[model samples]
Target chain A: MSDASQGASALTPEVKGIIGATAEKIEASFPWGIEREGLRIFTQAIMDPDPRYWDDEFAAKTKFGGIITPPIYCTYIGRRTRPGADDPITRAFEENPYSDGIQGVRTPETRGGLPNIPTPLVRTLNAGNEIEVRQYPKLGDRIFSQAKYADIKERVGKDGSRMLIVTTETVYTNQNDEVLCILRASSIRR
Target chain B: MTTAQELRDKKQTWWDDVDVGHEFPPLVIGPLTSTHLFRWSAAIENWHRIHYDQSFAVYHEGLPSVLGQGSWKQSILPRYLKDLCLPDGWPWKVSFQHRAMIVPGDTLTIWAKVTKKYQEEGLGFLDLDVGMRHYAETCPGRATIVLPIRNGKPIPYPFVPPKKLSEQTS
Candidate 1:
């Protein structure tokens, strides 16, 4: 915990400015691609319950034509893996000071999650989630992801404090750029 | 009472007969494995190693196996609730807190009780305290669902006039 506190205070003005500038530069690179192995690793991490993921025979029986991936798997695909490097999740965890696991304290780069944007001084919360499934990914399919800073707005909640809500929209496509899923997530900052 | 009369008197609605002390119907789900995680990951495009790489998860996070994503649990809640409630029964609001870790192979018994029921805005809403317990340990997540009263019509939103009343009248 103390380590996280130290990391939080280390964000100097220069670092903040650098990250802000970088965020703009990165935004232009809208969509990115993910490796097949990386995608495999992440699904395993979340521990999905459905057997169609595990049993080949059962998966073949389903309409998906083979094993299908879970809905939330898009969150990890095609993210920049390192800082000033391109990987989205890695950059957030490795770079970006002030990423102490608290909302609004960490930038998107510091959030260490895929399909996350680099934003400063905001806390990310699961406002809500909606999933629409067109088709599920088959085994060994390389996924491509396109991410953009979708929206940022300010509003006053019932208690009357100004809050900044930032949304990052990412669309996942297959190697052929076929649309797979669209993820729209919002994070709150004080 | 005669057996035939008793049979006729039985309540069909879960709300009418379910008691506060009653336990929810048990649902057994999964012996989760790496393949399951892999498919889920590929489907969601998740690349996190903690999910699939058991060595990394155990050494780094001190977990026995990959931890289930909180979102997956959220998705399952609807299914569990639906099994207990009727087809048209929809939960208005659900709030859950992650209390314990749920891994593959852990058989969880999801339980809920009807704590209260009331009418608000002309809709009958049932408040339920729901939980999931595995191996006698409960997780932090709990949910509250609002069920519409049977045979009651849902309220329609009031219409908003395009122009002010004064303008229309004038």
Candidate 2:
């Protein structure tokens, strides 16, 4: 990371300081378990007509013993606040009406309790993700996540512009601490 | 009362059914609306304003219009890929880069084309180059899908991966 990345506006020492920092485990629950309604709308949103997602009788006949989630749910809807916890939604709007709400000045959205890395870049975008689809989290499972700043680097784009690319990895687990999936997510800030 | 192989094949996307250049049927969604974006935002619990606040997105953020969450755009890709593999097989690994922004009213057509194929742990694997577009390829990347081979056993429930394939394997 030293030699090859030296050509551009390299990352500042403060930015580089976060490379291997891992966050404490964040425990959030699906108190009512994973909701069937959530499953329906998500599949509807994607236009997935698979009977496994929609058919009750058919799902009952499968090895999963009942309706199972569409594995990708591990990333999208798996985590939620613990019961009796503060509402992040209500908090965001109350905090800043005009804020983008994702990375606002008061608070930036952290993934699975990963700590924030302060950067000079104002705007952020979800660059993409490297995901390993592992075990499926069942309905009524409490989802816990532990995250880390896998890497933070500077890159010179085609127009000689520089931006900081941040990558984070989060592991999702059930209440029993059974591993469900590992997601390597990256975002570009400029 | 089902064999593991039978349970697996119930939703199996056949390894024998594909080749290096095979293309999965595309999933077309949208002429997206703010309503669509808002519901998704609420569902995922990502309360970002760009997804719902038009005035803020246009004037303050300098965006073309109220934007769709990249994660929402991302949700479409793997859902299609997983169904393509179905029942027994898994959309084992996929990576995507959200290059272009998705605005309201943009129709997204998600696609994947097989790039490589191999065998490991007695299961079949196929690599694919994928894209999400509204005429231009906005988000692009690759994925590796695990599938059941002809007359092979089930691919397992917890979806165990083989010994580290390679950094570039996906």
Interface RMSD, per-candidate values to 1 decimal: 13.0, 6.0
- CAPRI class assigned to model 1: incorrect
**RMSD vs true structure, all candidates:** 12.9, 5.3
DockQ metric, candidate 1 = 0.07
- lDDT per residue, candidate 2, B67-100, as tens digits? 8887776777777777677667788878888787
Q: How much lDDT does each candidate structure score?
A: 0.47, 0.74
Candidate 2 residues lying further than 4 Å off, grouped into runs, are A1-18, A78-97, A100-112, A115-126, A152-165, A188-190, B1-11, B166-170
Give the per-residue lDDT of model 1 (tens digit) for A46-112: 4333544555666576435566555445544433333454544445556644332222222345332
Candidate 2 backbone collisions, by pair:
A33-A140, A34-A140, B11-B86, B11-B87
True contacts kept of each: 0.05, 0.64
lDDT of 2 at A112: 50
Q: How is the predicted docking of candidate 2 categorized under the CAPRI scheme?
A: acceptable
Please report the candidate that would top TM-score against the real structure. 2
